[model samples]
Target: MNYLVCVLLIGVGATAVMDLWAIARKRLFGIPSLDYGLVGRWFAYLARGRFRHDAIATTPPIRGERLIGWTLHYLIGIAFATILLGIWGLTWVRHPTIWPALIVGIGTVAAPFLVMQPGMGAGIAASRTPRPAVARLQSLITHGIFGLGLYAAGWMTSFFYTP
Candidate 1:
């Protein structure tokens, strides 16, 4: 398979899996998923040179913020997928191991904890949330799921192209 096509397939497939998990969690546990619209708003402001917000929800909504946020979310997933491939090489994609995918998936929490959370005024790892520990745990779990998605997507891709 083409390198770029493989990346898109794995990244998008993994992100879709994570989204499905979020939907399931919301229905099963009543835990709300992060609003990608807010992420979009943050990015909008980010483009205009704003980095931090007292509370992103309170911030003004930008046009097409929802779409922008969702796109960014998937793009970030793709970037992480790229990172996995970069570290492990295309050979790993053919084999589809769980460890590297999980490592990258779990490690992705850093982006939200350090950058997204802080920039959006949730504090590091959601420290400012009403239930910081719970929020942290949720983030960890979600990212872990993303890792599993990565592995699953890798396996699915492997089925399509040999070598």
Candidate 2:
């Protein structure tokens, strides 16, 4: 299989797994998942030359914000997959290891902690939230789960692609 095809499959599959975890988390723990619509809104504002928001939830809704956010979410996943491939090369893709995938997945939390949260006005690492510790833990767990998803997806990809 083409390398690009492998990347796309692994990325999409991993993201889907993460989405499944979000649903399970919400249903099992009565905890809500990140609202990707807000992500879309943030991106929309960024496109308009605005970077920070006092509270993205209060921000005016933009047309197609949900679609934009969902699209960006998957694209970000794909980008991360690219990063993994870039670092590890095709040899890793052929072998599909867990540590590298987990490292990249967990490392992704920095994006939200430094950029997305601050831009959305949640404060760094959700310090501004009512339950900062819980939020942080949740973020860590979710990202870890995403890492597992990456590993799982990598295995799935390896099954179909020898190279």
Candidate 3:
């Protein structure tokens, strides 16, 4: 239905905004953007019955992993957007306020902290990283930016929905 399409569009748009922030962060602060290829490698191993890695970056690279990782990144974004819509309902989408979107966007950090990082061997919330505090802060900031992106996307969506 139209609602479904709207959710997908908002999700994709918000995620794109997040990515743009990453690029800007890298350019302005000398921070490196995440190499989603590791994500792909981890996921590729899922097919072979491997669920965890001591160090995903050291794991053998999977063929087409770059493609897979990038694709998964967007898919996960879409999933998060779907979660937002499910929790807030279509009425929220029609009105498109920033607070709900921001909360959902910030809340999504759990997936990376609890699920993705641990699975990739970075430890829960990047505990095993060389600089755990820095890693955690970076994650928080990135997710916060994602929250802003969600708000921006929601505003755009509202603009389109208005009569």
Identify the leading candidate in terms of TM-score.
1
| Residue-level lDDT tens digits of model 3 in 1-163 | 3677878888888889889989999999999999999999999999999988999989999999999999999888888889888888778767888888889888999999999999999999999999999998898888888878877887788777743
Q: Ten consecutive residues with minimal summed lDDT in candidate 3?
A: 154-163
TM-scores for candidates 1 onward, in order: 0.98, 0.97, 0.95
* Clash pairs detected, candidate 3: none
For candidate 2, write residues 1-163 as lDDT tens digits. Answer: 8879878988898889899999998999998998999999999999899999999999999999999999999998888888888899778778999999999999999988999999999999999999999989999988888888888998988888864
For model 3, the superposed segments whose C-alpha errors exceed 4 Å read none
Better of 1 and 2 by lDDT: 1
Residue by residue across 1-163, what tens digits does model 1's lDDT show?
8778788988998999999999999999999899999999999999899999999999999999999999999999999999988899889888989999999999999999999999999998898999999999999999999999999999999999656
| lDDT at 34, model 1 | 90
Q: List clashing residue pairs in candidate 1.
A: none
Q: Clashes per prediction?
A: 0, 0, 0
**Model 1: residues >4 Å from true position, as ranges?**
none
Cα RMSD, model 2: 0.8
